[model samples]
Target: MPVSVLLVEDDEVIRRSVALALERYGYGVTTAEDGLTGLELFREGRYDLLLLDVMLPGLDGIGLCRRIRETSTDPVLMMSARGDALDVVSGLEAGADDYVVKPVDTSVLVARIRSLLRRTTFRPDPAPDPPPDTAPDGPAPLVFGDLSIDTGGLEVFRAGRPVALAPTELRLLLEFAAHPGIVLERQTLLRNVWDYGWDGDSRVVDLCVQRLRKKIGAERIETVRGFGYKLRR
Candidate 1:
């Protein structure tokens, strides 16, 4: 099935143009002019991805993204005419998997959408040997402090309780857990976790780390001054 997208933009011109472009690329595009209607549509139908404009009527993109996060971990891509650091950071902090400045090329928009979707299906590499002895079938969980990461099952547990994480956050944690005690550069994280190669934004990595820390315990992942971030083993 073609990937489905929910695009919420208040600008008629941009909404129509983007919807048309996405359709041309064989996507199942659904367009809404405002945030409330978008939310309604979202609640009514399932989508592979979401493309939300930051500024919207009724409810803004940030608010909408937060609402969605309450119930779903599906990939969300935020678009905004405001490209300032504050605006971009706000979107990411609101649980957006990715952000794109408005007036964006349709090709680039499609690429970003594909990247987010790709992450939804991502699985971590085979886990390390199951904590000495206690043998089990399949890949074993990687334990860090009180946190347990079942890479094969793609589940995270904190102190024996499950932790709900968005795909981006889970992937980031997996990368850090895979390389415990080693500082992972922002660029390296962007490539491995976000699949952003060179066209990457470090703030995305930074904000995601912040969110992941909140769930898995802030002290578990340490900031390495100018180097990068490392998982506390």
Candidate 2:
């Protein structure tokens, strides 16, 4: 089945052009003129990804992204004419999985979409286990207040209750829990958790951490100033 994409841009020219390009690339495309209509269409349809414009006529893209994040985990790629760092950060903070500046090359946009989708979809195979607890010598399970990370089952529980987590969030939390109290740098975290060769951007870590904090409690993870983050013990 073709990957479905929802395009929400007020610029008719850009919207139609991008939609056409996406369709040509074997993707199902749905276009909306503004955020409100786009969100409505999104609610009524099933799409694998969302292409959102930062500026819109009604309910701006940032607000729309926040609302969508409230109920959906579908990947979002934000676009803006303003190519400022603040704009990108704002979009990511609003729950966008990625951001792109305007005057976007269709080829580059498609490639970014592919990369974001790939990262969101990849799942590492389960690690091999040691033979039946014969004098286990590994680290103990990470325990922070009521939260516990079970490496064996790849599960997280708070007060014995399971907390629902997105795949990306789960992987991130697992990496942090594996090394409790260690302030992992953004570059190291990006390389280890996402398996990216370079540091890329740190916003990915920030956004994931925000989501993780919300799910696991704000105080569950401590941020080290100018460094990175550490799992609270």
Candidate 3:
């Protein structure tokens, strides 16, 4: 089946153009002219991904993203007319999986959509069961407030309920939880969590941290001025 995409934009021209492009690329497209209608369609339909414009009538994209995060784990690619760094950061902080500046290149937009979908869709293979005696000496589960990180099962629980987390978010959380209260520089985080080479840009760390904050709560991660970040112990 074709991948279904929800295209939410207030501009009639941009909306129709994007919807046509996505349809041409074998995506089954659903469109909404405003945030309220977009969100309503979202609740009623099963879409593989969401293409949301930052500026919209009723609720803005950032606010809509937050609302969607409250209940849905589906990947979101945010579109914005503003191309500033702050704009991108704000979108990421609002729980977007990726951001694309407006006056968009349809080709680049398609590539980004593919990339975000790929990352969100990936599921790592489960590790083989360890021997019974190999269990750690202390607590059976590592606790972080109401959240539990199960090293053995590679799963996370919040108040005894399972929380759906993306693979990247899960790995980043585990790394921070392993060294609670210790600040990790962006470079170190990128190398360890993303396995990226030193030459790669550190913005990957920022994006992942934003995603993690959305899941675990922003107050749970502390930022050290001009340094990096740490998970609150």
Candidate 4:
């Protein structure tokens, strides 16, 4: 089955062009001309991904993202006419998984959609979860003080309470937890956690980190002064 995508853009041209491109690439595309109608369709229908334009009539993309995030952790990709740092950061902060500068490249957009979907999809019956512990017994789940990460299960727990994490957040946590005490450079994190290459969109890492900190606690993931970040061992 083709992946379902809800594309909301204010511009008629961009909307039609993107919807056509996505359909050609074997995607099930649904489009909305404004944020109000977009949010309505989103609430009414089921979709695998959301492609939203930052500027819109009625509510904006950021607002829509926030509203959807309140109930679902589905993947959201935002686009802005101006590739400004503020716009990208704001989009991420509003719970968007990724952002694209407008006049989007169809190939790149497809690739981004693929990556986002892969990250967001959860596996069924995740390896039956090993005994929860940080024992160095070769391939045990990672434990940090009060936090527990079932690497095999791809689940996280804090103080025995389940920590709900988005796909990017979980992947980022896995990266840091896998190499406790080792500082990961921004570029390295971007390449590992995102489809971005080189120093591409380091703020994506930062925004993800910020959200992770809010869920897992700030004192756990330490910033390595101009270097990057490391999970406290």
Candidate 5:
């Protein structure tokens, strides 16, 4: 089936143009003119991804994103006319997986959408059963002081309880877990985790780290002054 998308924008021109572009790219697009209507559509239909404009009447993108996060972990991408630092930070905090600055470039927007969708489709093959009295086959969950990451299952546990993590957050944690105690540069993370090329913003990495810390414990991830971030050993 064609990848389904829910596009929510208050601007008539932007909404129509974006919907058309995605359709041409072979996506099944559903457009909403306001945040409230967008929320209603989301609750009623199943979509592979969500595209939201920051400034919307009734609910606004940040609020709408938060409401969606309360029950769903679907990939969300936001667009901001200002594209200021504050707007980006707010959207990420509200559980948006990625954002695009306004005057939207169709190519870049599609690339971001594709990247987010790739993560959603990724699934590590389940390991064959382990030999008796030995560890399970394939990739086992990485264990930290109080956290556990099951890369194959794509689930995280804290103190033996499942942690509710968005797809992006889980991917970030997996990256950190893969290289425990090693400081990961922002640019490297952007490339490896977000699929950004050379030119990418570091704020996305920083905000995602902050959100990961909140779920896994702030002390679990260390900020390395001018360097980068590292997972505690």
Candidate 6:
């Protein structure tokens, strides 16, 4: 089945254009003119992803993302005309998996959508040996002190309790946990985690790291001032 997308944008021109472009890419898209209508559509339909605009009527995109996140783990990609760091950071903190600035190319937007969706779905990949005494062939879930990461299951736990993470957060953690103690440069993180082909703004990575650290504990992910981040082994 084609991937389904719920597009919520208040601007008619952008909304219509994006919906058309997404349709051309063979995605099943449902468009809403406002956040309240989008929320209603979300409740009435099943979608694989949500393309939300940050500025919306009635309920804003940030609040709407939070509401959907309360029940759904579906990927949410927020779009905004605002270039302010605070605007983008607010959206991410509100449960959006990713954000895109407005006037974005349709192709790039599609790529972002694909990247987010791809991270949520599992595929075969190599892993290090499981902890001693665990299965050697099938890499066991990563255990670092109190934090537990089930790469296969795409779940996380801290202190024996489940931790709910946005798709981006989980993907970032997987990269960090995969190579414990190794510093990952900002450029490397952008390409690997965000799938940005070019050297993108590092602020996105920084904000994500901060949020991930907040949930998984601040001390585990260490910053090597002026370099990058690494997971403490």
Best by TM-score: 5
Model 4 misplacement above 4 A: 122-140
> Distance from true position, residue 11, model 1, in Å?
0.3
Worst 10 residues of 2 by lDDT: 133-142
lDDT of 5 at 191: 88
- Per-residue CA lDDT of model 1 for 6-116, tens digit only, reads 999999999999999999999999999999999999999999999999999999999999999999998999997978898799999999998999899988888888888
Q: Worst 10-residue stretch by lDDT in candidate 4?
A: 121-130
Tens-digit lDDT track of model 2 for 168-203: 687789888878889999888877765566457788
Model 4 lDDT per residue over 105-175, tens place: 89988888888887677553434444767443434678999999987677899999999988889888988
List the candidate 5 regions with Cα displacement exceeding 4 Å: 125-138
Query: What TM-score would every model get versus the actual structure?
Result: 0.94, 0.80, 0.71, 0.90, 0.94, 0.90
Instruction: Return whichever of 1 and 4 wins on TM-score.
Output: 1
Over 4 Å off, model 3: 129-147, 151-154, 158-168, 174-204, 207-233
TM-score of candidate 3 against the unseen true structure: 0.71
Candidate 1: which stretches are off by over 4 Å?
A: 123-136
Question: On a 0 to 100 scale, what is the lDDT of residue 9 in model 1?
Answer: 96
Scanning candidate 5 in windows of ten residues, the lowest lDDT window is 119-128
Task: Indicate the residue-level lDDT of 204 in model 4.
Answer: 85
87-198: candidate 5 lDDT, tens digit per residue:
9999999989999999878988898999999876767765787889996555857999889887877888999999999888888888888899999999989988898866
Instruction: State in Å the error of residue 91, model 2.
Output: 2.1
The sequence of per-residue lDDT tens digits that candidate 3 reaches over residues 92-205 is 777776677899988878877776666555455556666787863433677878878877666788778887776557777888998999999888876666554334445657
Writing each residue's lDDT as its tens digit, candidate 6 over 1-233 gives: 99999999999999999999999999999999999999999999999999999999999998999899888878889998976788788887787777889999998999988888887766756776678887665546899999999877778999999998877788899999989999999899988888777777687888889889999999999999999999999
lDDT of 2 at 104: 94
Query: Model 6 lDDT vs. the true structure?
Result: 0.89
- The local distance difference test score of each candidate is 0.91, 0.84, 0.80, 0.88, 0.91, 0.89
TM-score of 4: 0.90
Pairs in clash, predicted candidate 3: none
